[model samples]
Target: MEEAADGDWVVRPITGAATGKTYRCPGCDQEIRPGTPHVVAWPAYVRDSDLDPWDVDSAADRRRHWHTACWRSRDRRR
Candidate 1:
């Protein structure tokens, strides 16, 4: 897992070979096709956070897939 520069998220790279389903990128609102390399990111779970960071269901529900470039430039987009 990689931390976002802003410390707001935890990101994980997904290999092309591992991506079997399509996903819509929240950044660009475009389709991430199957077999495409991408990233999966979820909110950073701080200790004793109000969102119940330890809850696996909460974290899984918040996970989003993003294109590598879109994720890299996320802060710059409107």
Candidate 2:
């Protein structure tokens, strides 16, 4: 867990098998195929004050998938 200017982030390194879902990598704007290891992350804050636990589903929507290389150097893609 770490806090930055953007927001609090819970960084998790995970194996692709665990995901059981395909996602698009925001860092590279490419498909993150299932069974391919990647990163899954979520913000550590609550967006709505009245919401419970900050709305995990909403956070998941906001969370981004990233290729390992893209995460290491996203600026290169830009």
Clashes of each: 0, 0
Report how far residue 36 has shifted in candidate 2, in Å: 1.0
Q: In candidate 2, list every pair of residues with a backbone clash.
A: none
Top TM-score prediction, candidate number? 1
Question: What would the TM-scores of all predictions be?
Answer: 0.75, 0.63
Clashing pairs in 1: none
Predicted structure 2, TM vs. truth: 0.63
The deviation in Å at residue 56 for candidate 1 is 8.8
Q: Estimate, for each residue in 1-78, the C-alpha lDDT of model 2 and write its tens digit.
A: 757555676767879768778889888788988898987777776567426645455555566778877765655666
lDDT of 1 by residue, 4-60 (tens): 655667788999999889999999999999999999998776434535645554555
TM-score of 1: 0.75
True lDDT of residue 11, candidate 2: 69
User: Predicted candidate 1: what Cα RMSD to the true structure?
Assistant: 3.6
